[model samples]
Target: MTTEAKICQGPHTGGQGPSSLDELVARVAACGARPRIALAACAEAHALGALLDAMERGIAQPLLVGDMDQTARIAAELGRDISGIAAVHAPDPREAVQCAVDMVRRGEADVLMKGLVNTDVLLRRVLNRATGLPPKGVLSHVAVFELPASGGTTRLAMMTDAAVNIRPNLQRKLEIVHNAVAVARALGIARPRVAMLAATEKVILPAMPATLDAQIVARMAEQGEFGEADVAGPMALDIALSPDAAARKGVDHPVAGCADILVAPDIESGNILYKSLTILARADMASTMAGSSAPLVVTSRGDSERSKFCSIALAGYLALAARS
Candidate 1:
């Protein structure tokens, strides 16, 4: 099969993508097969609560890999019953992460989730050369957001590499786009409109490298490098999402105003946008790491239980899509 065909293969309804996180969860539940999620260091209350919620919704089957005593304690504190759930005892946090990663490698789990463990610790094991999960390409983070639109409706949008890929160059940025495109396709977007974000739309060479890279990437997209997606580059933030802003700036492109994905120039800008939306705009969001052998849920420890649950659903949906 072609790369595009592989990326776009999945269960979707009537060629329409989900407009909200709840709809995404519903679709995952409707898939009829629960993806097994291995929660590393599963002793944290919020993470456990989220996993329990996913289990109740029939979106995921949890395999707790942590301190069983602590897990039980957290479950009790949250008034949740984990008696029917399966768990492996690994008191050490790193050991728990390793065990969970091993389960994913062994096909016993379809997703790997971070719990009480630190992000760096969990990632070290996941990116380990010999025992780690083999990446399809370079691993990049994709954050999915459901934002309020002009017509009192909401639309799902995505931003990439906010939590990974510190300073992606032209080549690495291409890989990031590929990873984000795969995610958008898995989420039922038939032809994702991708906006390559930079400080400005004008390319001024060495003065602003991001704009040059964005222009080149956009040209590559025009050459069918990113499959059926519409990629336009060097777009200012305002022009990417606001039709009025695009019109005011006279930016004419298919992805100018109604972009489904925003490709940030670097980690700083991407991370800033991510936190701002979550905290200030109060946007509903879900995030996952793409290019891994299996889906990975690595939401911030400060993220709400709802966010964690949605992240699980997002990852679960991707896992099911890969299987189908």
Candidate 2:
């Protein structure tokens, strides 16, 4: 969301990048156990297809929670075989969401994946006060992307409350950071460096409270607020991405160059930035709602097959990593 300088890579006008799906899948496979995942609204064509693919690859053991008859019909239409798959029938989407969440609460499923259901409906069950997977306020959305130019190593970036919190205050941002850091640790990142993004590197007057919040977050981290994570901020996007840009601008932050995570100011900026990267830049990404008792894969139905597959792997990774 920062008005930072545009980042340009060699010969690629639109964004060029390596997908993290393959890498994540490989990691899951190496764990030697197929993680159990529950699918909400599992009857959709894309949803069933992706679940089948994940099952066949041994990355996930899916507990399909939706209209079983409709799931079968969709699978049949999609030329998928549901012979060995286990499913729990829920006639309505709202019930389906609760079924999936219930599986997680009961330890029947390790992760939660949303299919054709509206995110709001599914989230209502997840955020239910008396009965839910985790506490009400801890849920946040995290997207992990691998840049093509960067090769091999996976880069972790986080945007908070993209699908949930509209405009978070300063205290809420701390929770967001904590949630993001937990996700980073799940991805095997040790001591992740968090860069709080703003429109500029310096905190300006009356323009962006985010800049000041970034500074405050950094100080909080210094005071042992966030364990094992280094936080720095009020940085523009370019400064976060390009080490050279930070040096040229006389910035001296640990996360200036090679930042592992970029925390956006608000939902508007975070959502817009994510969409820009996916639509305009052509970034291959997978997102999930995390910080709950179970990971929730909440990719849109419009997402590509690759995106869905990556999200499945991500959910499985978190599930497996949690065990370790």
Best-matching candidate per lDDT: 1
Clashing residue pairs for model 2: 17-148, 18-148
Give the per-residue lDDT digits (tens) of candidate 1, residues 129-248.
Answer: 689886767889999999677879887899997898999998899999999898888888888899999989999788989999999999999999998989988998899998899999
Prediction 1 TM-score vs. true = 0.93
The global Cα lDDT (0 to 1) of model 1 is 0.88
What lDDT tens digits, residue by residue, belong to model 2 across residues 136-174?
Answer: 356778887765435455554555555666777888888
Q: Least accurate stretch of 10 residues (summed lDDT) in model 1? A: 1-10
What lDDT would each prediction earn against the true structure? 0.88, 0.76
Deviation in Å, model 2, residue 109 alpha carbon? 0.6
